[model samples]
Target: MSKQRPNLYYTELDLFILLSKIGLRRKLKPSERRVLVKVYYSEYATPVVPVLITNGKIRLCGDYKLTLNNNLIVDEHSLSTSEELFNGLAEGDKFTKIDLRNAYLNWKVRDEDQHLLTFNTHKGHYNSTRLMFDLNGPPAKWQRKIENILKGIPGVYYL
Candidate 1:
């Protein structure tokens, strides 16, 4: 019988690519960015160690276990939407569509409830908890805002 073993060695770039592939990538705060890069470089041969420390987890394939809450927020596009809602079909109408850049990022999740956005890694688990939106139930204010917008539409509309 013959026995074979797999090689687990990795290069610096390999670690970077691995982290990126699993969605473990993050846009660090201005100050944290420098530190993060240094941490990655300083521990190049064993980047995973620092990665687990800095990110507080060892994610695999970038899949994070997201726990949805009742106070969830979601993009309008994610909801059941109709093209006619914003389509300017009237004759001689100048249609204008504005995209909200990084709209979800503009939202702030309360510090107390940030733990909802966490992931389990190969080593342990970590989370930012600062959710930009909810995927489950929604806030009352958001529901009212949508309802108000729909009610205020001057023409016939259906969702």
Candidate 2:
């Protein structure tokens, strides 16, 4: 019997093509996270949380559960249930699905709060200017904000 493994590496062209595929869908600000190539002595950087590309979509994620998620406070805002969304829909209403690529990172972190998100890596120390995934607070915060935004609109709904 013979065993074979699929190639799990990506070339630069692959990355360029991947980015091109979803670039328009995610025409986000280039200033998502500042590339801090060096660390200051006074800055307290968290343990290294490497950039994770989950799939072909080039969906980047952060794994701060071990390093940062613990000390942070979780927002207690209630998230909407499937039942609630269905109940709110009327006969004449239509559903519009929007896909946000860099989901949590759409929200920028505050200047003061950005310091807490600093991470140390072999390459260099870095900090996030925008919200990163695996952070405890964004989902609830975003849900609350979405609810508030849709609340004022006449026919818009969020899922």
Candidate 3:
């Protein structure tokens, strides 16, 4: 049989614990609960996927496909084609590459929308405060955000 590859994700800790302190749990305070959106009932929460250890750190994520991916209205931001990428460029154009580390974490989910990102684990319930990679719309959302910010800047292109 082939290996059972899970989209692998989860671990839990006390509310707002640092990455160094995973696997610990504590009850959320009222104010902290305001921001975290704790799922009191597992019925409303999606199961956390699987867990992996990378660079001696724990990485937790969810399989949103089993939950939010289908129902969500995907952002319809179309991508540029190869021809479009080259359209504004000239011969011998110097190129530079810039990558934003932890780029998804830069965008916060709207206050009303955070609960849509919530997931449940054996340990507890939780939600993302910022955009996560597994969500269906972030690529388009991020692309649109970048495009909006870079609109008037000259000589800049994104794929």
Which is the leading candidate under lDDT?
Answer: 3
Model 3 pairs whose backbones collide = 9-50, 10-50
The whole-model C-alpha lDDT of candidate 2 against the native structure comes to 0.55
Off by over 4 Å in 2: 1-38, 49-54, 57-62, 100-103
lDDT comparing candidate 3 with the true structure: 0.62
**Which one wins by lDDT: 2 or 3?**
3
lDDT of 3 by residue, 97-125 (tens): 67853586557788766766777665567
TM-score of each: 0.38, 0.63, 0.64
Candidate 2 lDDT tens digits, 8-121? 122245444443454323534545325232445414455532243556334444346654566666888866678867776765356777875346566767777666666543
Clashing pairs in 1: 22-62, 58-121, 58-122, 72-134, 73-133, 73-134, 114-129
Candidate 2 weakest ten by summed lDDT: 1-10
State the lDDT of candidate 1 residue by residue for 1-159, as single tens digits: 012221222335655566665545664566433222221111101113223435566532212212233233433423335665545244435454444332433345565544444333232334343333323333334544555666756543323
Instruction: Please report how far candidate 3 places residue 88 from its true position, in Å.
Output: 3.5
Candidate 1 residues lying further than 4 Å off, grouped into runs, are 1-17, 20-27, 31-66, 69-83, 86-88, 120-126, 132-159
lDDT of 1: 0.37
Best by TM-score: 3
Q: RMSD of candidate 1 to the true fold?
A: 13.0
Clashes of each: 7, 0, 2
